[model samples]
Target: MKKNQFDTKLIHEGYKTSEYHGSLTPPLFHTSTYTFPTAQHGEQSFAGERDDFIYSRLGNPTVQILEERMAALEEGEVALAFGSGMAAVSATIFSLISTGDHILCSKGIYGCTYGFLEMLENKFGIEHNFCEMDTEEEIQNLIQENTKVIFIETPINPTMKVIDIEMVVEVAKKNNITVVVDNTFCSPYLQKPLTQGCDIVLHSATKYISGHGDVVAGIVVCKAKELADRMIPIRKDIGAIMSPFDAWLLLRGLKTLAVRMDRQCENAKKVVSFLQSHPMVKEVFYPGDFKSQNYFIASKQMKKGGGVFAFTIDGTKKDTQEFINHLEMIKIAVSLGDTETLVQHPATMTHAVVPKELREKMGITDNMLRMSVGLEAWEDIVADLQQALIKSNSNTVC
Candidate 1:
């Protein structure tokens, strides 16, 4: 049989209308436990002799549908859903690392991910180092014997600096290190890290996969089933499974993933152009920009530039806030990949937990702003930025 295209798979890959009362949409199974025909069946389930879902914590029908769909989307063998983005991050890292293990990470990471790494080092004797990973040699230099995992966020969170996945994977493969890429920024619509040789790909499904800001969830897709098996026990023990209702919402959100991302990518290009030409904008960093350092890598791995980008303004932190405050439509929010355009200041808002020195080392600065270009009309979004930049210029601290 011929394979379905990417967009078609997003909507229909893991579901059959006839399986659940002929409903076109996948039915939500909202129960905490599943019934068994006999005590023998329950015993078998507990012993792992049968594949029945024993409890919501272990598995749920609606969540399984989501997992299956995401696995297909990400081109992975298995996918697991989680209660929050941090939960998925925690479970995947814990599954791959031991108390004495070391982790090598990309230079820039989401603030909560930085916090989680800090917690692991302080509490469990696990340690990590952040590297620019500009080349295979740089990644090789940072690797230690105890390094068990290479965790990276391409387009590196708020900075929007694209990393070469194939370069990292090449170095990791030579070292027998497990590579995990955070696919939150691009979602599966624009990028699939597993296809580029990463061992696992994960996302904060609250963003693009949910689209509406109504759900907080995460998903992890592993290239191999052994990795999935490793995470299953961890997710179950940690009790961070996604809710059935959240899975249902994601299912609906995913059906429009392609179209939403298409519009966002187009909108972001126009917004980037406006920001670049604005006198008050010092510089913009987006892989979509033709002259960006890693634009070639981004073009190789991603279908498009994606919806998020960052810029540093010709102003102080106070002026940056003034700009954000003056925006009439774009929101001042930490989260990204939504239908609504959102902006955040990393120095004060999201990356505040990291020390100033470390945040600076991560290329996050007081004058920088990260914006997730939304599904709004490009002209309207640009108008908001124009007015905000004008207001911000006036309020600059001289």
Candidate 2:
């Protein structure tokens, strides 16, 4: 099947019922270990002579189905599932480089990702350099002989900064470094980084991929068979594989990804428009907005601006708090890409782990708000924001 037909592929690309008594849906193989028919068969499985599952930590049939479906969605050679998004990120990074190697990363990434890299640098001696990564010159200047990987998060968490994937891939190729893109925001429906020459794409499937926000999972999709092969052992040794039930939930989530994302994107566009025109909103950060700094890049690489965007209120941190507190329809939350609209303050919530000075340097200000527009009616979402702004302004004046 052609991978380009994404919506069709989402439902039909991964599993076939003929292998499991024509059940229609993939079954959750809840066993921890698989039994071999004979002693020789078990020996063969251990000796790598037989392609079979031996243990759940190493592999599971249900998890494999989800991996295959995600691979198809991302147009990747293979994919690996993890218990959580951080496991996928850490395992993939550990598999690619040794302790002495250096990594070049985007400045505005997820707070947990930043914390993980810092821990790796301090504990394992792996080095990392963080920069805006908005230009080829910036990337070129940061490249060092010891640099082994270039990691980036486009439409960066909470800030919505869009990085140029193709340009970064070109720079990595020139430097003989691997490029990994954290595609949690766009998912595969909106953007496929592998097709843009990125070596690997990672996702926090707990977000858009699992649209209902019920499961916490992560996946790493590899463009090359060799990279997938290298990552498998690391995942097995770390024992961070996804459970069969979580995999099943993620599989169900994949089926509706195309549809859920379409509506969410539509809602986000309307929200951006409302925020941009509001008097209390100082700046709206959405790549889809024509006035955005990264609008051109977002237009070139993504099908639509994703559901999440950031905006700044024309007031202090207290005003921002008032705005969030006054919000009646939108929920104050950290994670994005859910069925319900969510809002968060990065400086106090997501990026709190980073030093205040560094957070400020990354453009995550105290007054900034990150919003994840949901499947709610656009009018209702707008009205909620309108009233919240009015209430916040009124509170500030009094």
Worst 10 residues of 2 by lDDT: 1-10
The C-alpha TM-scores of every prediction are 0.98, 0.98
lDDT of residue 61 for candidate 2: 95
Model 1 per-residue lDDT tens digits across residues 1-398: 44479999888988878888899998888898889999999999899899898889989988999999999999999999999999999999999998799999998899999999999999998999999999788889999999999999988988888888988999999999999999999998889899999999999999999988899999999999999999999998989989999999999999999999999999999999998988888999998888888699899999999899999988788777888999999999989888999999999988999899999988899999999988989999999889877776766644
Write down the lDDT that model 1 would get: 0.92
Instruction: Report the C-alpha lDDT of model 2 over 244-271, residue by residue, as the tens digit.
Output: 9999998888899988999999999999
Any runs in candidate 1 off by more than 4 Å, and if so which?
A: 1-3
- Candidate 2, residue 72: lDDT: 88
